[model samples]
Target: MTNYLIDNAGVLIGPVEFPVVPGLGVEIPSNAVRLTQPLEHAKPGHVWVMVDGLPEERVDYRGVVYRTDNGKSLLWREVAELPNTVTAKAWPGTHYYWTGDDWELDQSALAAEKKAQVLLERDTLMQHAQLRIAPLHYAEQLQLITQDEQTALLGWMRYCVELNRLEQSPEFPMNMEWPVPPTVGTP
Candidate 1:
């Protein structure tokens, strides 16, 4: 009932339904091959091949991910187990890097991305610190602030200075020691 047209490599071109030739019954195409027991529909991602003069079914994994030595795309099973190939999910921003033999996380790139995020966080903390410091500095200049207010102002200033010095720490952006803001009501 169903015949498949295939290329020389046995890759399926399309399915064909032949008309009855009256006395001859069905007129199958010369280039078409059919399974011994043909199914109504062919399975997806399957290849039909002539093995030992009979049609055989095999998997077609041309869509599988395979990368060349320089990270260019290529078909899977084309160069499988080859020394210069890296096979892994090639999705964007996954941070997967090819080493000489295997895939690994690119530490330097990861650190750089994390550093940028940390810098943004530091800038935000500094902006919030400045908001608290500006009014206190003005109060001190007018001599209208109490002793408790002076101590609070000094604590906030020290916190600000610590925040500025965060980059000087040996851990820096990678494993930073964030400066805690002074408590509002505590001495």
Candidate 2:
């Protein structure tokens, strides 16, 4: 007969084989239980649990396959599934948090991110518009600007103004209606 040593929580600690004296009955500890089939060595992240007096394998995060003499038997618990969030998987530029029971959007963080993106786009557009207007403005002061150059300068200036006014819109950082930028060198 094969006897398995178990703890108070029924975790299989080790095995005590029978017939230690060849023909004599084995001396088993109080925590040992006899089993019809021999138990194999438990794998990592798994434990041999005694469910209703029957040995069964269960998932154990603690990796408590076997314990030393001074080690304590840990209670087996069923791990609950994690709640699904709006962003199901982790990726770059994505943020999510757990709100006690469910995953919720961090609105403030999203707003801040959106605001930064909008500001970056606006700065780029403003710089482009300013560059296009500089030579045209100087040419106009010298009376050397053509009508097409004057028209292009006005369109670029208007685009810059629109870009600056973007932050004043009601949607602001959340939803922005970006103004159409003028063509590179035409009105």
Candidate 3:
């Protein structure tokens, strides 16, 4: 069994000895074998942002604005194009605006339309949430079921396990050993 050294405060801390070369500073214990496989990377554009608010909570025409990591307001325009007829409205003190074609409103009808739109938007969001949870359900099934479903379930389980291990120890080395220094005098 390989024993690895872990530095408490230095560059390499908490090192464990393993057959494989620890890619990063920390080492892996040789006895600790991988139990599961790694998860595959989600396809490009797989992730979607889910906002926590109602349509009324959303400013009309303005869509939504997000603060960028740079401390600037990444207005909706960054993710989508803006429409014409821009006007700002203050809601509960926070100003929101519409930058799109104005619609002539029959007050009551407009209210009903807004209500319907909110419901539709909520439904769509719920569907997206379901899709995101499906893979997790499959993984849970892998953990529970046996016999017939074992093989298929194991694949997903492995993927999840691998992904978690990778996250915990991203520095696990691919190669097992380092090259030895050549003897200077001996042939």
Candidate 4:
């Protein structure tokens, strides 16, 4: 059974999903506008300062003064083209490298860069945490245990077995064998 109405000529009819008529979406038009479809690159004649590397290493002499990454009041201005009194007062942390032009994205890429740095630091910390290993020994056979060494050798064997069983990966097994070299004992 047909759910949609059709004309006598047998063409399905429906309300238009997109009709063309627009005033403006915002109460006041903003200089900074987000594209409905983002552009691959900044518009022509636009001055864009791309900040990716360490700030200390980057040399930007454009009029745009950037906020230092250290989170202090010490703003970084171009030594050659320092901001005048009025421009310096208005310069914000949001400034990266500025094109003398006014239009820019409301948010910069700085936050994502900072987050990546934090994750790297956390990974370094985890690698420094030591995994404890209990003392152990290697023996050729059960008969090798002497009167005084019997108890010690038995304890070491049990420790190795329990450690391997607890930590071994079923899919990709590790060499859970003791890492140290065994020396010949004095009989």
Candidate 5:
């Protein structure tokens, strides 16, 4: 189990002191509050502590922090519509910080968004891989070659590594067949 504490600057608007216990996972409701700012300076791996007992509007409200081994990280981007799960995009090295209240994005919230673009790039890279030469083709298939592409790929690779180091996974097999040597084209 992971342990975390509520940030000192993250007190609620009212005078009530939020209770935080060690080894507890904070639950943020789907509708009440959204994380608005990037809690970049907060401690690493500390869970967001939620308040208990409120109206139904406040029921099921919670949030938490997630840190990856990579240097890049961000806050829990969640919505009340999803009920209990908060979605976050983290890179290779990062830690979590709990910002008071739930956060919502405006037109200017591109600073921490990565998932959609990354997914699209990965798809594009894979499509490009299908037409390239072997081995070199396979390496390209699994990687993003451009600088920006590489940054995005590294984020995804880090996430996968944290979940289940694919390099060591037995189910992940490598293709050793070389592509047929190109014959003289009669073009």
Candidate 6:
């Protein structure tokens, strides 16, 4: 059986159970935590680290310090979240914090305030004039135009095309402009 202590820095001091092979019967190195066992329902002082939901080997959860050995080095890491602390998965959820009195949801009263701000912004955009759509009527008359008419209409868009390099050999613009694009969706 693996030996554990009930004292020290909650470091679990025990050898992992390894199966005995026919020819390989050598002992392997391991990590152990010396905890104040008699295993009470007390919070671990500083043994485990609770970073994510994924189980961590070298973390002290409650009163147990988990340890892991990856054949190379034994790791005894502490999770980011300490015991007796309230936490949440992400934003827009009921975030909890450890209050002196008890575990409280949103120690700061900013959850509803921030959510209201987002709703206000959304409503403002929906009521803006730019958001209203109008029925666009294409020209009913078939206007006869030369080949150059269509190209002239699209001249504003040609600022993006790379010039003075291709075999097509298009003439350069009246003046050189930076190759920057429109920050917004519209060109």
Quantify all predictions' global Cα lDDT against the true fold.
0.68, 0.69, 0.34, 0.33, 0.34, 0.33
Better of 1 and 5 by lDDT: 1
- Full ranking by TM-score: 1, 2, 6, 3, 4, 5
For 134-182, candidate 4 gives per-residue lDDT tens digits of 1212232535545445555454444444433433434212222322211
- Top TM-score hit: 1
Task: Summarize candidate 3's per-residue lDDT along 22-95 as a digit string, tens digits.
Answer: 66764545333221222233334221111331111122233333322112233343222233322222221122
Poorest 10 consecutive residues by lDDT, candidate 5: 178-187
For candidate 5, what is the lDDT? 0.34
Q: For candidate 2, lDDT tens digit of each residue in 1-187?
A: 5678877555787676654665665666678888877888777657787888788887554322112211233432332222232222222224555444334567898999999999998999888788889999999999999988888888888898999999999999887799997775653
Q: All candidates' TM-scores? A: 0.62, 0.56, 0.21, 0.20, 0.16, 0.23
- The residue-level lDDT of candidate 5 at 178 comes to 21
Between candidates 3 and 4, the TM-score winner: 3
Candidate 2 at residue 60, lDDT? 56
Worst 10 residues of 6 by lDDT: 131-140
Candidate 1, residues 1-187: lDDT per residue as tens digits? 4477766555555566777998899877777876555643445656666667666566555555647344556656521234355454463344556765566777788878888888888889888878887887888999888787788789888987898887788897788778898986233
Residue 83 of model 1 has an lDDT of 39
lDDT of 4 at 179: 23
* Comparing 2 and 6 on lDDT, the stronger one: 2
lDDT for predicted candidate 2 compared with the true structure: 0.69
The C-alpha RMSD in Å for every predicted model, in order, reads 6.1, 9.8, 36.6, 21.3, 23.0, 18.8
lDDT for position 51 in model 5: 49
Residue runs of model 2 more than 4 Å from their true location after superposition: 1-93, 184-187
Query: Which candidate should be chosen as best, given lDDT against the real structure?
Result: 2
